[model samples]
Target: MQTIWAPWRITYILGEKEQGCFLCQKARQVEHDEENFVLCRKTHAFVLMNVYPYNNGHLMIAPYAHVSSLTELHHDQLEDMFRLAQLCESVLTLVMQPEGFNIGINLGKVAGAGVEDHLHLHIVPRWNGDTNYMTTIADTRIIPQQLEETCELLRSGFLLEQKER
Candidate 1:
């Protein structure tokens, strides 16, 4: 197996444990969409670009209320969460159409929920050979574009569409 280098993972090393709820913290902060990478905010849910994306335009639609279990969400929140996910796909198709996608939620710690306190639906854009030898053999992921660039592009489209409407 060839060794693959991914320098970006270092950004997550220090202070990761000290960090609290990312979704709540970002929503409370003073920043533009490009800074926060927030796409849309609904009554019960909101969409945001993944700070660490599996691909260039990866996104997550999450309920505002922090809950680990799928059954823990109020009916309206669950509906709005999936609805926002659909909207995310719609926007991604319009702006950054990939060949395919990976969408799901991991409910618990063992199930791979990085933030088990809050539920977020992941929308990962996929293409042929996306899961190549690097992931399986080398334990690395090669994402071509920077998260900030992707954030800027998505936020621009979202803001433009909002203004048009």
Candidate 2:
């Protein structure tokens, strides 16, 4: 069997997991936005890159409130989250030029929510032939760009986008 060298994953595998909601932690740590991979912050929600992404430009829009489901969010929070989703799509389109996008929220653990307690929307950019043998056969998804670089690009993109508004 051919081995894939993904040394970065070792940090996540061996690192001590932090307690409490990571999204909430990130939300509170505004000064650490770059380290947290936060691209944009709305009034009630924020957009950040997925550290374990399904695709290179994968992003998550999450409310500041620690709510398990959408029903728990105030209308303003829910609206802000969706607006952040639009911002994610716009910035990803400008920077990555993806042909398509997959945007949704996984409401529960059984429905594929990794962080089941925090309500978040995922925006995964897609291109033709993005899925290949590596994913279908080896069950490994390849992300082409480094997270820091992507974060910087998207952060700039979001800034430019906000400036135009």
Q: What is the C-alpha RMSD of each candidate to the true structure, in Å?
A: 2.6, 1.0
TM-score of 1: 0.83
How far does residue 150 in candidate 1 sit from its true spot (Å)?
0.9
lDDT of 2 by residue, 53-80 (tens): 9999899988999999988999999899
For candidate 2, list the clashing residue pairs, or say none.
Answer: none
What do the candidate models score in CA lDDT, each in turn? 0.79, 0.91
Clashing pairs in 1: none
Candidate with maximal TM-score: 2
TM-score of each: 0.83, 0.96
Model 1 global lDDT (CA atoms, 0 to 1): 0.79
